[model samples]
Target: MPKTQPTIRDVAAAAGVAVSTVSKYINGTQRFSGSVEAKLKAAIDALGYRSNPLARSMITGKTRTIGLAILDIRNPHFTNIVKGANRVALQHDYTLLLVDTEESQERERPLIEALAQRVDGMIISSRMPDDAVQWLLELSKPVVLFGRSQQFPIASVGTDGHLAASMLARHLLNLGHRRIAYLGFAKSRWNDERRRGIADCLQKAGLQLDVHDAEAPSAIAGERACSAILLGSSQPDAVICYNDLIALGFMKEARELGFRLPQDLSVVGFDNVSYAEYASPALTTVDLQSEKMGELAMTKLIAALNGSHDDEYAMLEPRLVVRESTMRRPDTSQPAGVTEMTPKTAGGRRRTGGQGA
Candidate 1:
């Protein structure tokens, strides 16, 4: 068996034509006279030739692969999104090259530049800074962002973070809780979206949100932020977290501070990540349709790759998921340590705290 793939030059030589002519013929963007086309076809067949994805990309400037830059692959939240992208990418015979920024734009920049040569397009999770984004845009490659915001102009697929936040706020307020706080991630589009959502929900209910930034969305960050919030002069009747990990961290810290769930405080988280249910009290959260968002993003990207220059953006809706972590305000007369909290609508109606209906 031949060890090495045949090169374009070899094809050109065999066909008795210049390499550029052969490349143009192969890419199908150039018109060739009848005799030249026939000769090239004959040479291709005789060489048992297949286009080298790498070499062809070098000549035609298209890798046919998409680069995916994720903040953290270890987090189930990001992985869930990737699963969706993978499904769609496979359907189009496209490969996804995943790179972790680890929440650092500086580290992410060089990685993106390195991968740029290997991919025709990029789907970014927004670890890049403004300068980097501007640079990427200037590079003139097709880019689709996962998180949406007015600040960025690239086509995007994002969850309805604002609505999700509002829903969570309203859920707690309807449970007869007067004091509620939001523990959210700071300095990101998703963070801002969720915060705006919370504000919207609070406004509709004639309530105000006590928003606190966790500095990080990681479990450790959640723990610290929760501790600080609980230690404050006034403890909130309920807490809403940026994501499930933060919620779980808050719960753990709240327990340490003798703040029992659904009794001393109700808690809700966003993202509804896998670990949300496995936590001690299980987290009440907003399902951001994360996986579905990923799927939709790739679908749009594929359409663009197939030569659609039309502008498209998608915002997946979110819904509240009632689990054990949220419920009606505790009976003041009763001592803490009760389990199982029921969910309430933003309008003060009781509902099951099971899976999302």
Candidate 2:
């Protein structure tokens, strides 16, 4: 009822070559004359022959697979990173094995350990503590850190969150926002970096930030934090969110509460995700070059697998993108003490004549 699968011996016989020659060709251990190559190809095609990857790996001592562990697969920022890493892996004729830790520290070690058994090396974007990550280095596999940098003797690639947040803070400060609030994520690995950047910038102007933390990084968490931020004793002129999803949620809830965007309050977010520009009034955010970080991390890991002993660290610069979500605050000394909301036409374009900062 079933036919036997062709083996290397069958291929060699069909091509009229030695079994060793067929092995060399399949393993890419040596080159052959064009005639021999063509004959081998024809034989393999006719027999529908396929080499066993396990057997080949046994002989070569390389699985030719790289494992990538991400904290959360739902985030578009991490998705872009995967795209960049997969691209480089394919170019090098290697397979990429992906695992999502679901932002859980408990899942990271077990997932990484299981992946390590099958792959040649790993690229980890983890939420685990630093000591826990340092423990992983003892696995004896080439490991690259993604999305964060450290003084550890491992290669790492990440975006400068502090610098990016500082830029956003400065942008809002220049807009005359005196009472600024920062909405942060409790589980974020770089939350302190972003918060510190915003705080440091505001301190220069003799102002302090009103800090609030969301239980999670999702839009739901952001939407839930809206009441505390907007209904508090001291209302801020502007709010800076941890990421675009949170910012979008905050804006939606703020509007539902009858506050006009940038008229009653201003909002800014980080990680200029794809939909950030397509939001109702668009979103002002930071570009962290997520894809580039992925590419660099994969490249560095592959380099280590090739016996290159150098440790490299790459920190990408962030760019600020301004959109309609933020605007200059009304001058407090004005006779009216507040600026009137500008009317928008039916097509949703604001009629001209608003004052600029």
Candidate 3:
């Protein structure tokens, strides 16, 4: 005869609790007192009992799983977002189905189709354009967007990019940096909104925000983009990057090309990623509170799953973090040969002051 699998009922019996109590505990739907919890743990451990998600989900008509689709898991910012989502999902007796889209729009459709079939709902950090609403509307499940917004008015949670861009530009402008450059692609909503903010600040100062092109959001692309611009005569004193990864790349390549950081070229980056602070000169980037945004996004998605939320959007706050990588625009003079700068001030930051609203 086949050996019987240890059931929730068996564990309940061993723990001297009602079957309902065990169910609640396993589902993370209720809390138990210390003594009761301890007894249940011991019973389950001794019996080697495991809750079958499939069996439980079948009875409830809910897979109790959420999908998290990101552009790339290799980026530190996305990793933090995933970490935050996982934290909330675990507390609700749920797990995530992670999808790395590799930043490819061609692969997004297939991945979404597969994920929708298995998950109750999804949270996507989509890199696709806003006009791709038809595909989003066709999904079988609800989706909460992270860091990216679309024209479809789907539920989203992210930083206010316009306000963030204004803050970044204001910092550079206040430090007397003229000919500040922005590095990123503008086809996405995130880029367009930020571009508007950068333009707003620059126009007020009677200066133009130089738009530079990057092959991708990675450091390698940043390096290459900066190199291309260096070949030109008009060089920006400060460059606002799409993210820390790009900023790090541009900085690395700039130093290799014999330019000293902050002394000759000040760099500003978005996303205060983990390695941003530990980079060579430490990155001065925007703190979008990415983890908090992810937590809020997951909470909103879960609430939507429970039919408790409207299809509304939530915008988090943004702020600037000053570090060693940026400073007041210096002499704008090239070093005779590897010249080092001695500045009057160290690192500092300014408050964003208000939201994009």
Query: Judged by TM-score, which candidate is best?
Result: 2
TM-score of 2: 0.87
lDDT of 2: 0.83
The per-candidate count of clashes, in order, stands at 2, 0, 0
- Tens digits of per-residue lDDT, candidate 1, 98-144, equal 88888885687788777776787888787543444667666577778
lDDT of 3 by residue, 27-56 (tens): 777899999999999999999999998977
Residue 184 accuracy (lDDT) in model 2: 97
Candidate 3 lDDT score relative to the true structure: 0.81
Tens-digit lDDT track of model 2 for 1-357: 799999999999999999999999998889999999999999999999999999999877789999999988888888989999999999999999999999787778898999999999999987764545676678889999865546468778887788888877877777778889999986677888999998987887778999999877778888999988999999998999999889999999999888899888889898778888888778878778888888989999988988887566788888777778998887743222223333223234322211111
RMSD (Å) per prediction: 6.4, 5.7, 6.1
Is 1 or 3 the stronger prediction by TM-score? 3
CA lDDT, every model vs. true structure = 0.76, 0.83, 0.81
- Poorly placed runs, candidate 1 (over 4 Å): 1-51, 127-132, 149-152, 330-357
> How close to the true structure is residue 294 of candidate 1, measured as C-alpha lDDT?
84
Which rank order by lDDT, best down to worst? 2, 3, 1
TM-score of each: 0.79, 0.87, 0.83
The Cα error of candidate 3 at residue 151, in Å, is: 3.2
User: Which whole-number lDDT from 0 to 100 does residue 216 have in model 3?
Assistant: 82
Better of 2 and 3 by TM-score: 2
Residue 92 miss distance in model 1 (angstroms): 0.6
* Colliding pairs, model 3: none
